[model samples]
Target: MIPSLSEATIRHHTIAQSFERGQGYYRAGSVHSLIQRGDRLLARVEGSEATDYQINVYFDQGGITRATCTCPYDYEGWCKHIVAVLLTCLNQPDRIEHRPALATLLASLNREQLETIVQNIANEQPEWMDAVEVQIALLTQSKTQKSQKAPRRTTVDPKPIERQVKRIINRYVEQWNDEPALDEIREIIQKADKFLEQGDGNNALIILGAIVRAYVQDWMNLDGSSGESGAFFEELDDALTEAILSAELTTSEFQQWQKELKNWQKEVVDYGVDSFEMSLTALQQGWEYPPLQEVLQGNITELGAWEDEAPDFADDLAWIRLKILERQGRHQEYLYLAEAEGQTDRYLQMLTKLGRSQEAIALAEQEMSTAGEAWTLAKTLRQQGELKSALNIAMQGLSLGGSNHYGLAVWASELAEGIDLEIAFQTRLKAFQLQPSLPDYLKLKELAGHRWDSLQPELLDTLRQSSSSLHAKAKAAIFLEEGLIEDAIATVTQLSSYESDIIHPVMDAAIAHRPDWVIENARPRAESIINAAQAQYYHHALNWLRRVRAAYLQLGQQEEWHRHRTALMQTHTRKHKLVAMLQQRDLT
Candidate 1:
């Protein structure tokens, strides 16, 4: 019923910043395969991550009635990937031309046409062939048995599931060479999802549960030098948790599974708390499993009483109890538990939620001696309309002088809103004097507003006079910001300690205006970086070398470039990897 989406409508639905980022993604050709099926538009968007995220946007008469993406950005209603897809749709409306559903398209194709299409897909993606073959077999069986009544659902065997889990992990470990097997692990989990989609939740749970056992039993003890193995396990844990929550089981079935879990807990060494916590969460969310509840309640009581003997277990148990109490609207019990556990944030949150503002204020004031407490108290005071008190607390925290004083200063300035801009500027300037950081200086300039031009000289003077390394950088930044490229370059070159990152802007500026100077200054640093870089950093060294080459080219100094290349080759003659890398790029 809805009209085709326009760029203006997309802008209306999305925030400006998200829209801009999405536009960049679209321009980069990140969105692809955009198609319309009935009222839905689906596309694949390549994101910052290795995998592409699939986006589905359902439109109705109200424009975009619903949209979902596979990216982990639930905080924003839609992510840049979603925005990219929408922008693609707006820019290329013809791309959303109605495509027949897969079933309909398949039905219309002749046997030879279908066979050719399947053969082509199988050649490109053999994994998809398994599903297709299974479907074909199922169809043949259905046709053969069409005259008979429907058969009972067959149960999936746990042995085959366990074998599949072992096979997947073994293949991943062998092929990935100890790297994180996130993609392989997700592929295995997707098989379980297929079961769930086919109304076999119990089978899905079994598959995920088997994978968890295999991971803990065999995979955890391996040398995870790549650091990806732990992330893989985390993903596995999430899959297991999701399956436990969503899978449906009868009372007897649930009790049997509970028994198996307890048996595993006793048999396995340091059994993971993730599954147990997920079970507790399911109970908290009103899952009507009586035996599971009894088991969890007993464990909670046992762990709660063993606080001194088993502190870790006791803490976990307490968290579960707190979550349950909070969910049940038992604020009094939640408060007592929070206070007992010394959870200040939770205690404060509970107080505020219960409309006990006076008590919350009292607690906030009492906790204001610590930097973290001061910031929290100041924000709470501001929210309570006690601006002066908040400002005083923030100022006191800043005077105490710690790592977090800059944050305190910002909080104080925000509290001083409508009071006095001059006072706010002075406070921020004092913070800059204390820290001499670029961020604080910029904040001070922001508060200066219309008078920033007048204040610029004083700011530059302060930075130039300061002995701090950060202040020196700030001075160079100011020069660059004001477009005094020569001054910026001169200041950076004269610095006693040279950071390659800080020298980059100066090098870039010098390349255009003073190519000779860039060639002279950059050669030694590039040589040092190339010599010191590891195999992984070879690309970074190559990029720096490219910059040096560009500088030489800019000055039309081909002979000097050849001489520099010869010198590098002679100096690093024994570094085979470096020589090969340079020769590949014709740098040697």
Candidate 2:
């Protein structure tokens, strides 16, 4: 069911909070629209570029609330776009609306309801009965198309087995949507079975192991049918068990398989510490499968003991496990581990996962004390929609880091955002004084980009007092802020011509101007950046295009703008997607 305007806004706010916490601010910008689809919202934002972002907000079977983003900063499920979208909704609540009551309930169905729903779906959409056939047809078409292509043998240099295994892992990861190489796996298993039939169990064990490795690396291992309990792995896992049982293993072969099994067992245990269960009956029937049962028992017994000890180790373990569980899409397990640890930082981090930042920060401040920690804690506060507290903590953190330190310098840059522009300007002045390096000078200028108008009187006074780099940046900032676009472009173009690394801020400033001067002056540096690229130059070029696009749009030069946009889309669309995501968000 569709989320109410209020619910959607709240969800978006949650995402924005995440964006701020993770430093997801790229080029701050505004949104044009948020199109709704069911519980999902597709938001279009204008920044240095234009792009679509998706947000999903839903309730689980237990009526637990959840939200997620397709944006890159959504590594923790929440991001700045969500927050911006939410804030946008809050300011204009007429954007949100509830789905009709007759529409599908915004909740999961119970077992009986699910059965009824299935019957209803079947009755209305009988094509669901042919789902398997449709899937098979699609697979067959893919294989046929592949077979029609000219085959060329590719050479792969032999590497260490571990390296080969890692390569195999990457191959499967890359082919996440493709079918597993199950035919090859079956071939290996057939060879192993033949060896077993010939009474060569050791050889069979070795071959079977290769088959098992393929399965372990295969993404299909995670798929499960929507049937009985554990229905997902029932077929494939049962086949694996049968293969092990039917094998005629000699003592040596048995020992070798045991060792290999133990390693696989270790990976499983590490990946799923909680909610992994094994039937004691399955273990008792065969010593080979005992490790699964043992691992489960060991974890259960340790849980009680773990609670009585210091929570630090538990927090650390939980942190490590959270990463694993997140990758596995076992989000609930990740949250459970975080809650069990009871560490403020850990809990706050988990709050990001659950989209509960206010609760997270309250807990975080109870224990957070370091400058870095305070900065981080402030981000959580921001995520929870506590803007006042977020700014407060950010100020405190900045003071603790001191003006000369890298942390304060970064904070100064972050504070340049709309809500905290004044604070950003003050902090930037201090930063320039502490470190007069070219980069620092450039950053100070960039921070002053939007603050130029406010700084005009002071900038004139500062120009008279000094002729330092700070004066140049302050002057440039004023020009840009005053909408004297050409003047700002000329200033930075002249400065960047002296040094290439000094090109970034100038490029940014030119883009901010969105003037014809940007296309004229930035062209040379852009070419130089391309010519002198060391792998990292592509990113700079992409940034150049983004800012260039922003400038073009501002100047209303549609034709040249489209040309630049097309070039950007052609050369670095994939590369810039993440950048676009970061920039599109309103981290504040």
Candidate 3:
């Protein structure tokens, strides 16, 4: 909020207030002048070398003001330019005292001044002049003698940090996009390629690093020319990282890969891990692409001799060995590693999954009281038919995390199967209020799935009065139960643009009813719509063409099936061409 100020003090107090409020917006040039109009302050600050900022500060009579800047930050609210203006008003430009004490001022003079004053005085008296001259000569001789004896200072050249960085990247580029530097990167790439060939991510890090280094290097320069490259790199990097980080690679070779990964220069990204981890995540899904997968899995098993490796490789290799054991269902050996690493959560989850719920819950609850852990415990207890314990776990989770209402509702619904509909509905409603997704809605419907439990009139009214779209979905669900397919379809279709998923269930139900009269009437109408408005319904028409192909095959209509298949093939070709163009753009 801006405060109102008069024309006279517009530049002074108003700008001061802006700075005091921490508005540090600045432009290329300093503030030139300021003026005031009707309830507004106009400030002219020099912008870039070629432009200037003409700002307008609108103020209200009650001492409220808002400034609009011409700079880009103005669009974002509060910028450095505003701060500059405020600084100008504070009147502390040089931040030095205007005056000084006599002794302090005299002390500031250099040795040259002291020498000059003494020499001038000495020249007025013959005896003093001679003495001063002798002293001056001695001083000059001493300076010269000292200067001649001192060793010459040599200047070391500034470290070429930027140039070194560039060279490193250029070499990396040559290695990945052109050649390989150390045998390690090449070996890794080869291993990754082989892994990709086999569709195994046993050596994900190596392949991920190669690709990440390639792309991250390309865009780090930040010149606008690399914008598209940067975007593509970011997307690929994110997907690849996700896949690698999520997949637990548990082999001696994979352990070596981890050891090699630690050698990479550590960098921090958006997530909780370092740059290597970030890169690993960013490129995880990239392995799904066949070409990339090939590049990723080129040299997996060829990595040799871990026993005589660097010290950093030991822990990583050991972890991989443990992961392998876990994958083989060798829980005892895996537990050895977990104990060594102090991984309580891993121990708990494994125990819970292995039907040791009581021990797992006790252990997890001792160290942590998290909703996710509690929820998992509840699920395990429920599965083991410990209703009382499961309910207690659910309550604990709800108390800890306000958002666990859905988990509570789930437990309630399960417990109330044949007992009380009202309790189930109430619990579900609480969850729905907190976070309403499809599953929650489905749970509510399921509570009413078996018997027509008359919802209290108020609850029914409340459902009807809720969101129009949700209400439509509820109505459609009711109609679906009554076997009124058309009505269900109609209710869902009312919000067709928004409720695409709702339509799927309704369509599934409607399509199940193939009464002769209804099918005959609807089939021709759909055909007429497709034929008369083909361009308008191109996507839908394509779907209809597919259905026709299937239906004709069922009816032994070979000619019709052939025609539909040909159309679909043509559409497929066109789609492929567009995809090819997009891929080409990525390479460039």
Candidate 4:
């Protein structure tokens, strides 16, 4: 007997929400025709859309071994359809036991019988006929010895692919629907992958190269701040890397690829494309084209002569040369090039790798006249276990104070361990004073530990006097955690401004213990959120309203809740989008 699908298995395949949704789907009789075939359980599940999705689950006594679905839900291993099918199987395992194995029935049929069955299936579903047509043609042709026309050789054009990518980017920019854009990009990448699987590396390269060129061009035109575009470029780089890894190329083929790459580079330069230098660098490094590396090395050697005409190209070649050297374990050569290139990061990395910490420290000290260098040197020293030196360097860096002052404070706190507790506490407090971030405050509290009680009054006084609301929120949170509920409430209520980060926590803490306080306090903030929210951010306001409603429901203040909601609807009558959202959530 096969074991039932466990809750653990459902959670393993998908998230909790999907599993819960699957449960609802199962309960609604959406899963049907569940059949057991060998170790697999198969079913059809009706989805939100009109078409039903096919679900396949491979299982045994241990539980589900594997599952798959035809639904386009790719984030998780198995989709909700699969989960629903599994639930159906677990609930009524006997229903599937009577179903005949499809493969066994197929094996029992004769060749002529199989042909008749195929013909019937083809008649019912014409789309199925395409797969069998080629085999049918081959069989008939052998019997008749008939002549066949030569198939047309279609040329692969990169333009269509490039145009489609550009169109998707433009659509995303106009509407900001990321899911469809990402799906289209992935589909395009799958096309390239199919070409690669068919051993057409050149065409695959062409498709990916076109995408890179288009992305770079678009990045040049855009504001250069859209992280989505950057993510897409990274995905292209990954695809290119995979394509390179999977490619099987001869010496001449590799040389041809190298030529094509150089041509692509030239095209990019001629077009003055910018902001995909890293992508290009990744492609070059991934290619590992031996002849190109050799040529680049030679170019690096003669860079002094070509510096006037092709200085940028010479620099690119030099960087590639350094990468190749590093790959070959030619560290000394890489170090020389790095030093010549004034790449401090690379220089320090090589020094550390070569176990030349003393030289690294000396170089860091020489550079530490600047704040950035001082922080870097201090971090390097700390990592190298020279704690005393690290502390002194951090102090020196703080004294210089040319920005990244928060970094110096963090370093000082980290290095102040086992030295002076008071100094460490002061350093942490200074870090909080500089940034007023929650993490720094948490760190300061942790450092204070048992002494936090003794330090509370002074800390509260300092926070109350501070101009930053972030500090005041931190003080309120500290008070809340310490069980000084009145103090927390008072501190939070005194704030003239309201931020969600400050409001939500305070509301959550007060909701059960002081429902009236939460009701009185959160109403204004929720209204402010609703008033300030744009069409795109109406969902946030709805969420805040939901929380507010939950608090009212808990307090048995349905009348007050209804009145407040009525007022909100009347006040925001012009915001049809927000009103529609509220109606959808049944909040009205």
Per-residue C-alpha lDDT of model 2 across residues 355-417, encoded as one tens digit per residue: 776665566556555566666665555555555656666666655632324554444344334
TM-score of each: 0.51, 0.33, 0.32, 0.49
Runs of candidate 2 exceeding 4 Å displacement: 1-318, 321-344, 347-366, 371-588
lDDT of 3 by residue, 112-189 (tens): 997787777877765787676656655665423422211222321223322333454456553233222222233434
Name the top lDDT candidate: 4
lDDT (10s digit) by residue, model 1, range 1-588: 224344544543455467788999999999888878776788899887898899998753324546889987745446788888887776777766678767777887899998899899999998998899768855675422432322325666567656765666676654545553545556767987776545355677788777666665666444455756554644554454455544566678677667655554444435433334344344233333443344334433332233244333344444544554554455676676555555565666567567675687677666544556566655665555555665666666665523677666654554454455666677767666656554455566667888888887887776666666665566666677667777677767755324656677667877877887776666666666676756666666666676688788889887888787777777888877877887865564
Count backbone overlaps in model 4. Answer: 0
- Residue 398 in model 4: shift from native, Å? 43
User: What is the model-wide C-alpha lDDT for candidate 2?
Assistant: 0.47
**lDDT winner between candidates 1 and 3:** 1
Q: Give per-residue lDDT, candidate 3, residue 343.
A: 46
Better of 1 and 3 by TM-score: 1
| Residue 327 CA displacement from its true place in model 1, Å | 2.0
Q: If ranked by lDDT, best first, what sequence of candidates would result?
A: 4, 1, 2, 3
In order, candidate lDDTs are 0.63, 0.47, 0.46, 0.63
Cα deviation of 192, candidate 4, in Å:
1.8
